[model samples]
Target: MKILISWLGKTDIDHMQVDKLAAIATLATKHTAPFDTVLILANAWEEHWHDYEKWLNKRLAVISRPAEVEVRQQSLSSPIDYVAIAAVMLRNLQALCQGDNQVYINLTSGTPAMTAMSVLIGQGMYQCHFLQAAPDNSVVEVRIPLDFAATYKKAVSTSVRNKVIAGPSLSSEFSRIAAESDAMKAALNKAAKLAATDLPALILGETGTGKELLATAIHAAGNRSAKPLKTINCGALPENLVDSILFGHVKGAFTGANNDHAGLFEQADGGTLFLDEVGELTPAVQVKLLRALQQGEITRVGDSKTRQVDVRVIAATHRQLATMVAEGTFREDLFYRIAVGVIELPPLRHRTADIPDLVKQIMAEINAVFSKQPDYKSKKISSSAIKFIATQPWPGNIRALWNALNRAVLWADNTELTVTDIQNATVDAVKTDESSPVVPEFVAGFDIQQYIDGIKENIVKAALDKTGGNKSKAAKLLGLANHQTLANWMKNLGIAEQ
Candidate 1:
């Protein structure tokens, strides 16, 4: 598919924006190859124009093509009118989108002028797709087909319904990694079908939800199964070092570059590269990544010569890329490229019915680990322990279950592990301060306001603690009316802002 990126000149190359671009580029290279193009359109404001060349050059160097940069100079004396800019961009995009299979990346929120242009152009463009950068540096892509826009109002209404009903799915092979519930299994089956194809797959879920595991499973089952599986944790990398690690650097390319080294792309040649936490990439890296994926080649950091490599890509993240795209922290084009096929893994609590199977499998594995010692033979779990595990909400999912089991194993002196042993281990491992000043006990004749305030405070605090202080998440844990109500309660209690 052919891709186009149009943005206002005044956009800043912030860390978050760069990271979003990197994620997009990675996705594009992995899913859609040999047929993609990127177009960058910027207004001619002094600030926007000043760094244009540098930014353009850097971006061009990373992507796999000779970038087509278009600079439109608006009259400085005239007040910036976004509607006019949108018209201009739409006209330009219309010409580029003549092909039947075409996509547009709208990064029009870099400045007030660009934001206005994006909204107008976005609303008017019948056949184009729009992508926005979110505050957390993720991308949100909106695909507006020309035919759909013919009856725009109805199409929008139906789109929401379709998405809600679709939910998300994962590949079937994920079932082997963990015993997932029916809902989760269905999601996995959906993902498996998507993985069989060459589409870029975005694996979304919460932390420890096995996103990487799913990616690895996809690579293992794909046509490129014989190839190596390379993984990179985007969030863990240093911003400055990302380029060299990904695209390689020539000897003396930087201060620490004593010798030339092939980057991860080269190493993953004829295989798959799995990028974890892709939302953490920087814009500078994004530009280069966009080029590489588009062109199917890479140049060492300091080298002018480009080297080609063949590799498939799989990416995973826990954050909402759509939200990041809206806030101008991500690249619109990159988002569209990687989102060809999206799969979301369900959290642990949502699949409570699968707990029994998971517990049995975990116990078996633990037993296998202790197989060597006759005195430390495999132990059997009591019915009460199994029931207790089923009842407690596992916020951390399989990871949390594994940890809890480990703790229980440590505390179990008998051949059979019981509910008391598990409970004791959980209480001992969980952090709680006994030295802190205690709130007065609720008395039968307590003041009504005081009693209500105390209960609210306790409930809110417990939920926050359970979710590690993520307010939106804490609200879900508490089963609050919504995030707003949780926020109001937090404000009333004077708890620290999330």
Candidate 2:
């Protein structure tokens, strides 16, 4: 798409003061071809900047040069400060250049410093088209056939490019996610590399292994950090409501539809959308998701109009998607598109080396929450407690570990949580997993298959009862991929929900 990016200058709004057409209008009319989108960076402090946006759109329509106008507010210390102006312009330019966009930087708008920086950045980094308004309000190409600006351009471009991905900011973004084990370190290393680009990423790991947390860190460390980071759990969404929630619907499209609704994709434009438990998406939703990722566009459930969105999708799931694809349950094409950059996080059992640090971190968090309460003493775990924690096979991963520690802290009378406290808190979970199965007698007409089915039925019913008939929670308790798997099991076992 041909995109015209320009700073909204004083002349662009004060039409009564200008003798002829505004600089932006002239550039749009006299250009070789009409632009698909006009991206304007306006001053945030200007009270009537939105008025200028409306005026510019109307002016363009009057002249038959209709382009989608997107105004982004930029806060600058000074309009003439070349450094400040270049920083704002470079950041926006970098995001624009990420796509296959034919960028045109207009030098006739804003101050003289703005124009100069635009030319330097455009020539040095992008080599995009540069245009300016002539004396008679005609648009002319501005070309500089000089090599002196090469050094300055190279230095500035490199800084802008490396500042977020390769610099200290990258580390800071992931600082909240603590890891000490080699397996976890490797996973985080892969995540850091993926955060440097705008690729659709897939995070594969067991549940409670912090997939969403890692996804958040990746978004914070990427180009879309300045925009929204919307998140949703696909497994938690009701089957009937999935379409409307992800792609929205027009008013009167459905029985409950009352007004126009913006879905997660539209809400996360120029940002990131983290889809947790993505393997739970139905086949129909998979097709629509693939189209959105492939084309950067989506249509409402019952609307024919298509809307464009620039969303970096980060999907996470504990389910083995490759296995699902082979089983003809998940779409292979969608898998490949979203798995361009995959990070497989090791479960807490495999990362026992990091348990001590995790214990410290989680305990600190617990203390912070109860700090303000009167007579609430800060608690610390004994070394023996940490050792006991590391010895267990945490099937629920980090989340399970945190729950045990939080419980231990709350129940213990002293400030120091001992191994006894930890054991008491985690006893139910460990005992449940370690329970032995009943042995069957080897008698005539014993039908082993029927006996096994009976056992399966009992287990399913027990899990359902334990979770109060919530299929999703019961599935998690039974170690199933999602509620759908639980339902399939119940059907096969000839069991019914209470």
Candidate 3:
């Protein structure tokens, strides 16, 4: 397959940006060899055309298949004047669309004109693939046929709905750490299915939801299981270091480069590279990444030689990638590529049924850890303690559960753990109000009717807040006997209609 990379250029090329693009081209040649060619289209003004071409040529020479690399520069009177330049490039790409060869387009670092041209070309070239650069400076390739605009639109709409309704999928690598819940099981099953395929998978979920676990599991189950499982936390790295870490660097490539280093791509050859928190990658990194994914090759920093590597990638994140893409924080083409098979993990609160089993397992594990002797001691968990644990909201999910159990085990002076132990340990950690205010000892002659009314009002208010002031929904949530009762209470309490 032949892939074309077209990007618009300003009067001057950023040295780092040029190097990154060169790295991508090298990587692509390695992956899609013998049939692929990269076409770089840049606009130049009269003053900088010669300098730009010289710089571009020097960078392009570092690519493995320099012969297959084509650089086209159109001249304009001024750098800012791109109207005619864009028109010509678009017309040329449109002409190239009629060819029988399969073409994939990279728009990750393309100028606005190039992006527009890509969209237009995409509409006409049904066989073309769209690749975008991700925030981590990786390439994300997407296959959207020209005739499937309607389908693409529908899919995007559904994806948005899923995000709103279900949130992000949990990381497959972190699945083992999550509590046993139906939602967790469903997420695991979905992850397993996606693991069987080679397509790029996007995992979404809130922080501490074990997204990395899911990614690891998927990688372990895949064909690359025997190879190294490399992981990069996109959010943890600085912008300048991301490319060097991911694509490697030659000796003396930068100030910190004491020796030549192979990047994650080379390390993960015939294995898996797990990108965690991928939403945090910068646009420059995204462009390079898009090129690498499209071509499947990479070059070391400060070197022109190219090498091919086979690596399956699984990316995880808690942020909304789609929203980021829409807001220009993420590349749209990259989003489409990584989201081929998306899986969402539900929060702990939604699956309360599995809490008992989870608690039992956690308690056993905690007991084993706490015992100094190698011998395992059987400890009984009080029924009241179990009941309390089940009722309390676990915002931190399974991690919180494990920590709570560890604390309980530490405080358990005997073989039995009571409700007080679990409550004290967990309630404080979860920031729950544990003190019951003593209740004034509940005098026997207290006004019972007034007390009931006050209790009812509090419950109504809590329910209303939980349901966002939707009276009918609040009535159902609060388990009020009927709508009329809720209405009566609302009127009596002087609660105006919301």
Best by TM-score: 2
Candidates ranked by TM-score: 2, 1, 3
Please tell me which predicted candidate would have the highest lDDT against the true structure. 2
Please write out the lDDT profile of model 2 over residues 1-498, one tens digit for every residue.
888999988777776235347878777766889888888888753676666667667777887888888778876767887766877777788888866888999888888888889888887777578888887888898777865467778887987788657654335777767777889888888888788889999999998999998999999988889999999988787778877888899999999899999999989988999999999988887887888888877888789876667799999999999999999999999999999999999999999888988899999999999898899999999998788788777778999998988889889999999877886787555433324346777788988888778777767875665455889988887789999999988989878866
Candidate 1 per-residue lDDT over residues 1-498, each given as its tens digit:
566555543334342245434423322333233224555555444554435535554555576544444444533323365444554566666666675856655553445676556555555664566665555545566654444345778886797699669985444556576555777777677667766677778888888777887888888777778888899998887778877898899999989899999999999987888889888887776677778777778888899876666777778888889998898777878777787788888888787777777788888888888787677867888877887777666666778787788778867889788877776555423332323235655668868676567667766775665455678877876677788999988888777775
- The positional error of residue 445 in candidate 3, measured at the CA in angstroms, is 45
Per-prediction TM-score = 0.53, 0.61, 0.52
lDDT value, residue 312 of candidate 2: 94
Alpha carbon lDDT at 424, candidate 3: 54
Span of ten consecutive residues with least summed lDDT in model 1: 26-35
Please rank every candidate by lDDT, starting with the best. 2, 3, 1
Q: Judging by lDDT, tell me the better candidate of 1 and 2.
A: 2
